[model samples]
Target: MKKTIITISREFGSGGREIGKKLAEQLNVPFYDKELIEIAAKESGLDKELFEEEDSRTSKGFRLLGALGYSLGGPLSTITELSLNDRLFLVQSQVIEQVAKEGACVIVGRCADYVLKDYDTVLNVFIHGNMKEKKERAIHSYEVDERDIENSIHKIDKRRANYYEYYTDRKWGRAENYDISLNSSTFGIDGCVEIIKEVAVNKSL
Candidate 1:
């Protein structure tokens, strides 16, 4: 198969991560969700907890040029020099670029669409579901408290939106920014995966 990169942005309870994993398996490529954190940690020599803490959170400091550069591998790369948020962002951005450069892979979240914006074979996707369905999915799949599910969903999605916009200068969940925006509510997770697979394959060919 032709090399292609798929990036999935999702609402907290949307099951978009599952679709990305299945799509990657169908396409015979590595899937990067949690694995991305490991890669960044290994390459950057940062604590894994740093990645989890800054996961999808906006950078606390402004250094657009620094974030764009990836060759910060030396003694100066210490956490004391760079903010943890900026360091993780740069390292993960580098890791994302490295993976896409290698070949086809499905990356879920982490502003991946914006990270690979210049790549020719990348397919950017956004997945979402209605509040009612998402809340139910959280309750059934994640066993989130029924009483707290709605607030939890809103809080998570707001963070995602803020992170995306802060880094990419693009609105989260906006259809125009992505190659395709899918509603898991309209099409089930399997259905969404099939459609994404079809689109990714066709584009690769």
Candidate 2:
């Protein structure tokens, strides 16, 4: 395929990652998800645990900032005094750009869509699902605790949204921010993969 990059932004429990992985397999390209963290850690010579910790703390960090009466300026507002999260974001973005420059890859999360916004051959997709179905999927597919499944789903989604918005200055899951916004509940995982693959292939051709 001629499409060099595909970035997927997804709601919690939406199977967006799965769709991305399957599409990459079909298109014969590299896939990056948690792998981005690994790549960033290695390339930046930072502890992998640091990246993982900051990666998971985006929402809590935002809340802490709010509690401290901080503004919601973008992550790079203070270049000289960067937080660990900011540092990780910078390294991660570098890795993303390097990989995109090298060749085709499917990237999930990490605000890759915004990072590669200038790429002419990139397709950015957002995946969402009905609340009821998402809860069910979380419990069964993702093995989330049933007792707090609903709360967990919302919390994770909030975390993702905060992370994307904080770094990219764009609203996460917003249709205008993505080339394609799909409903997993409407199209299912395989269907979503096929549709995205078709679009990517046609764009490449």
Candidate 3:
């Protein structure tokens, strides 16, 4: 059987991360969330904080090479030419591809969906929820400060959208970009996981 990779793009406070972890446990595969940042930092010898900062904010310039998964392919002296955000993105994307190549796994965020776009055995999923449901999850589950919680959610989602669009040239959360889009509000976290789990398992057949 061939290995399968699952990449999840989620709205903030939608419990999408939790669903991804649960699905990985059910399938007995590796799960990557913020772990990707740590791995990239360690592998690239860059500070972990750099990856954290670049993970959300949109890049200002120096996009083309990184978006295309270019690695400079030249002397180490060439690395200095790229912007900080572009450098970090290229490193993190390399980490994403390496892990996917290792085996079946679930990777959350950091544009793993776009980075692994060419993989034949990959399943891309986007998870979203209504404002009411997402707000509740944000406050109660994620503990996103109750004060101005709605604004906080909006900011996070927008950052993710901008970052994704800037690199992928595709609209984030659009149905056409993913193999499956799930409404966590309607199906609930476990339900969504079960749905993805079934599809992933079937793909390995």
Candidate 4:
């Protein structure tokens, strides 16, 4: 049997991870999320904490700094110094490619779509939810306080966007960048998983 690889890119509180896990279960395939980080860390000989920090925040810091000291000038050259974060990203990118080549799996975030964009069998998906729905989900699922949910959402999404844009030539969450874009808020997590499964099975056939 031919294997199918699904890559899901999602908004911070959209339950995209849950959907990916469910899809993997339904498809009887391996599911990858933070497991990617762990694998990357082991392969790259980098600390897991560094990978977590650099996962999606690289571009934001540089953008905020502007083309000033570290942005475009001498400090920028210094910034070129590959921090542990850069090394981790490079290692993780390789690991992601290796995993995709091994078999069918559902990979969530960390620019897996871009990493495997050249693969003919990969199906890339972008999952997002409306602000209200996302916030509610974050609060309930993550146990984030209502007061902190909005800020957490913003920070995480921004970091994800920054990381994606920095690494991939494509824009994050843009419909054009993905083979399919689904709103988890519209169908809920399980429904979205079902949709993904149907889509994957149909595509394989």
Candidate 5:
């Protein structure tokens, strides 16, 4: 069987990360989330904190070379300096490509759906759940601050959507952008995993 690459974009506090993990485990593929940040930091020799900051915020998301998944061929001499956000984006593109090349993998967030657009046999999925369901997941599964969970959810989702749109030139959460969309609240995590598995199987056929 051929390898498959799955990129999952999700709303904040929606248990998307967890769903990706479970799906990868079920599919017996590697799962990548925050691991991309460390890879970028290591490859660029930048501070991990810097990458983390860039990873979450959308302010500097629109940088040159972000449009086409920064070319990995040239030496570092061409670009004199890179902002943390740009460096992270470039490095992520490299890492995402490398991992997908090795074999099947499930990648969560970081606008991976856009970065891996050129790769064949890639499944771009969006995972979202109802606000109430997400709020509970945020507090329980993610251990988010309970005091102001509502605003936190909205704020984080906005950042993700903005970063995605800024980098990819595509609207986030739009049905047309992805191959499959799932509401985790409807069938829960495992069910979503099965749904994706079926779709992936069909795609392979």
Candidate 6:
């Protein structure tokens, strides 16, 4: 039987992780978030701490510039010259592909949607919330000061966007990049999970 794999990409402070977790529970499937990096580290023989350090973070401009220049040389040169972050991305991408091939799973972030884009049974989702709601959620969930939340939100989202764009050649958070784009603030967390579950069931049928 075919399996359904849902890939969720979200903005910072949007509660996408919670929604993905809940959706996985409702569907009785495994959920992957940062754990993907761990698996990738183990599978690829890369250091786990280095994987965590580079995951979902922006690439350095100098390194990207160097990579661009190096790409003009030859395929072998380009591959050999990849920055540490880019190498980690490649490793994690392989791990993601392996996991998807294994069975059904709900994968959150790390460009999993793009990694699994060619799979017929995969559903890609983007979750986002208004700035106000996101800030409130960040403050409550992370126990951070209100003043710091805005900057934290922007910083993290920018990093995610950069990381995703760097790897996928796609605009992050754009509706065209996903099968469904949800505003989690509109219906709240549980409601959003229910809606996703309903959609998953319908899609499976």
* Index of the highest-lDDT prediction: 3
Assess every candidate by TM-score.
0.79, 0.81, 0.80, 0.78, 0.79, 0.79
Candidate 1 local lDDT, 1-205, one digit each (tens): 4337899999988999989989988888989985765566586554453444442333332233245633333432343445565555766776787888888899998888888888878988899999988998899888888887799899989998987776666789889999888999999999999888888777554
The top-ranked prediction according to TM-score is: 2
Stretches of candidate 2 exceeding 4 Å from the true structure: 43-80, 203-205
Model 2 collision count: 0
Per-residue CA lDDT of model 6 for 79-150, tens digit only, reads 433466665666666677777888888999888887777888888888999999899888898776887778
Worst 10 residues of 5 by lDDT: 55-64
Compared with the true structure, model 6 gives a TM-score of 0.79
RMSD of each: 6.7, 7.0, 6.4, 7.3, 6.7, 6.5
Per-residue CA lDDT of model 2 for 1-205, tens digit only, reads 4566899989998999999989889889988996765565586554453445443345443333333333347342342344777656666766777788989899998888887888888998999999988998898888899997888998999999898877766777779999889999999999999889888878554
- Clash pairs, model 2 backbone: none
Q: After superposition, how far is residue 201 of candidate 2 from its true place, in Å?
A: 1.3
Candidate 5 per-residue lDDT over residues 1-205, each given as its tens digit: 2328899999987778988999889988889896754564476543443454442334233343645644433543354455666666766766676777878899998878888887778988999999899999999987889989999999989999878876666889999989889999998988998888888877554
**TM-score for predicted model 3 compared with the true structure:** 0.80
Q: How far out, in Å, is residue 205 in model 6?
A: 8.7
Candidates in order have lDDT scores of: 0.77, 0.77, 0.79, 0.75, 0.77, 0.75
Candidate 5 Cα lDDT to native? 0.77
Overall local distance difference test of candidate 2: 0.77
> What local lDDT does model 6 show for residue 160?
94
Give the poorly placed runs of model 6, Cα more than 4 Å off.
1-3, 43-80
Q: Candidate 4 vs candidate 6: which has greater TM-score?
A: 6
Clashing residue pairs in candidate 4, if any?
A: none
